[model samples]
Every structure is written in structure tokens, then in C-alpha cells.
Target: MNTQNAEMDVESLQKRRRGCFLDAFLVGSVMFLFAAVTTLAVVGVMTVKDVESRLKPPSWTSESGPLKLTDVSSSAVFTNFAYLEATTSGLKNATMQWAVQQTSVGHNFQYDRTNHWMMPVQSGNYFMYVNLNFTCTHICPSGDFTIHVGEGVVDKLSCKVHLPKLQDSTAVIKKCWTVSSVASKQKLISHMTVPKEGLDNWSLDMGLGMFLVD
Candidate 1:
């Protein structure tokens, strides 16, 4: 009877040990699965956030496009000159046009409606000239206008001019001036330096009488 009792006790103990071992294995597997799932979720969230940040503008920095320029015409008396510098990771050909703007004064110069000759194909500095006639009704103003570069408007000055004026006496006054007029016929040029990051192509579109696009 004693031996039988001892045998029964041993069997019970063995069964309990097996049950404990099985429970432990299940718990470990569940913990490992939970950890793996949590890690994957974290990684996924991070990737999504990174992509959203990249697409958001006014991007502190990134790539973008579809540049437009409008009716840019030159006058005989006051010529409008502009300089644009654009840099991009990816750039193709830039298209530009000159449009007509009805000014306070009547259009004195003949309007030549054609594609301006200064479109840039590659990455470098390009210069353009527009001859304008200035009607002395308003004082002739000349200076640099900021050219917007990139999808975001990054403004850089266009041209610098020294104007001669009549002072108090016979001596003519030579002064340096800057003007932001879209109506004058002036020389416009752009120097594009490629950016370090983002896409591969860069383009700049400067509408003579209007604003520039990049």
C-alpha cells in the first residue's frame, strides 16, 4: 500500500511539472509575438511620418515644379531687365514668354509677342536683354528684382543699374538705384547652381512684364 501511494504521488508531481513547462512555453511565445508586432508598428509609423514631412511645403527644403511666365513686353524708353538663378536636383528646359500689361500710360513701344531668347537648357548662368522705351511721365527707375528659385520662392536680385540724373547744376548726377517694376524693358539673367539634395532636374521661367517662376 505504501509503495502504491508513493508511485501515485510521483506521477502527480510529474504531471504538474509538465503542466508548468507547457504554460511557460505558451507565455514566452505570446510575449515574443507581442514584441515583434510592436516593433513593426513603430517602424511603420516612422516611415509614414518621414514621407509626409518630405511632401509638405513650404518645404524648409525639397524639390518641386510647373513654372509659368506671362506676357513680358519691352518699351522703348524704359527697358525691363531680369536675372533668375535656379538650382534643382532634376531640371529640364524652361519656357518663358512676354505679355502685355495695360499701364497707366499708353503702350508707346511696339509689342513683339514671341518666346524670349533666354531659355536655359542645362545647368549654368544665362543672360537675356529686352530693349524698352521709357516715357518720362514717371521717373525711370532701375535696379535688381529678386528671382524666385525652386518650387518655393527663393528670391535673388536680378540686375544693378547706375542712373545719370541732372543735379542742381550742369554736372550730371550718377546714382545707384534698384527698382521692382514688371513693366520696364531690361536685361534679365539667371545663374543656376544645382542643389545638393532631392530630384535631378532644374528649370526657371521668367515672364518679362510679370513675376518669375521656378
Candidate 2:
């Protein structure tokens, strides 16, 4: 019986030794995996930083430390433009004359008061616009009036309005266009044609504007 007990004790000791070795192997594998993941994470972060540094603009820094980006001038914000309003002086020939108001023009666009035309100095794409305001003083007949903006006898942008035969009627018309590759010194004028009845009853209202847009 004593020999049997000694054999059982030896078997138990062997089992404990095997369990201890398995636990030590599992701990080592976990430690190795954690170390590999940490190294890869650090390497990926360093690579991203290196790529960012390469992508930065050369203007971002100078010999005198980092440069302020606000000091650079941007041409996109400035635009040359002009605005003109219809004057009440020239109404006998049914042709409209435009003039720059003291508060209307912007960036010093070229204008010829004698010819009453807008002339662009720089040849490029330009936007043209016009607004025609008309109001009836007394009873009026049903008719349509056309407003034109262009060189002499050539219409570029135009708008038309139909007025019903009614007393104290009002009509507002607006037109705009983007002219591609406009030449320098090209003249543009705004004019209208109204019948005798329209001239007697319906007159052009204030705020009628013809302008050169950027």
C-alpha cells in the first residue's frame, strides 16, 4: 500500500510541472505580441508625420522662423467695376444716357460722359447688367417697351415689359449677361424705345441703372 501511495504522488508532481510550463509559454507569447504591436504603431505615426512635413508649402516657413500667411496679398479679392444710372436730361430721342453717380462707381471703371458709354480697359470676360423702372402717370394703353444695352445700334443685353392700360401702373425690368472675351475700349450703352402714348403716360422711374460687372 505504501508503494502505491508513492507512485500517485509522483504522477501529481509531473502534472503540476507541465501546467507551470504551459502558463509561462502563454505569458511570453502575449508579451511578444504586445511589443510587436507597439513598435508598429510607433512606426506608423512617425511615417504620417514625415509625409505631413513633406506636404507643407515652402512659403509656410522662411529663414526667419515661420512666416505669417496673412502678410501675402491676394488679387482675387479686388475687382474693377462700374455702375451708372439713367439721367432724365436725354429723353427726346427715346435714347437713354448713363452717368456714374458719386456713390455708384467702384474701382475706377472707365466711362465716357460725352458718349454715355461704359468702356472696359482690360480685355477679359465681363458681366453686364441693367435695370429699367417705369411708372404710368395717368391712363395708359396696353403696350410693350424694350430696353437694350450694347454698342450703338447693337444690342447685347435687353429686357422687355408689357404694360396694361391702367392708371398709375408700374413695371420693373432687369437683365444681365456674361460676355466672354470682351475687348478693351469696347463701348456699351443702354437705351429704350417707347411710343408717343408711352412717353406721355409712362416715364422712366428712378433707380434705373446700367452697370458693368466684373
Residue 143's lDDT within candidate 2 is 71
Q: Write the per-residue lDDT of candidate 2 for residues 1-214, one digit (tens) a residue.
A: 9999999999999999999999999999999999999999999999989854432212334487653322221222222545456777322345676544432443324667787776666766665555455666676566777777677777766767676676765554444343544567777666776665544566664333323344
Candidate 2 Cα errors over 4 Å, as ranges: 1-79, 89-93, 169-181, 196-198, 206-214
- lDDT (0-100) at residue 65 of candidate 2? 62
Clashes of 2: 0
Instruction: Give the TM-score comparing model 2 with the true structure, all chains together.
Output: 0.52
Off by over 4 Å in 1: 58-214
Per-residue lDDT of candidate 1, residues 103-127 (tens digit): 2111222333343323222223222
Model 2 deviation from the true structure expressed as Cα RMSD, one decimal place: 18.8
lDDT of 2 at 25: 96
Error at 154, model 2, angstroms? 2.8
Cα displacement (angstroms), candidate 2, residue 49, comes to 44
Candidate 2 — what's its lDDT?
Answer: 0.58
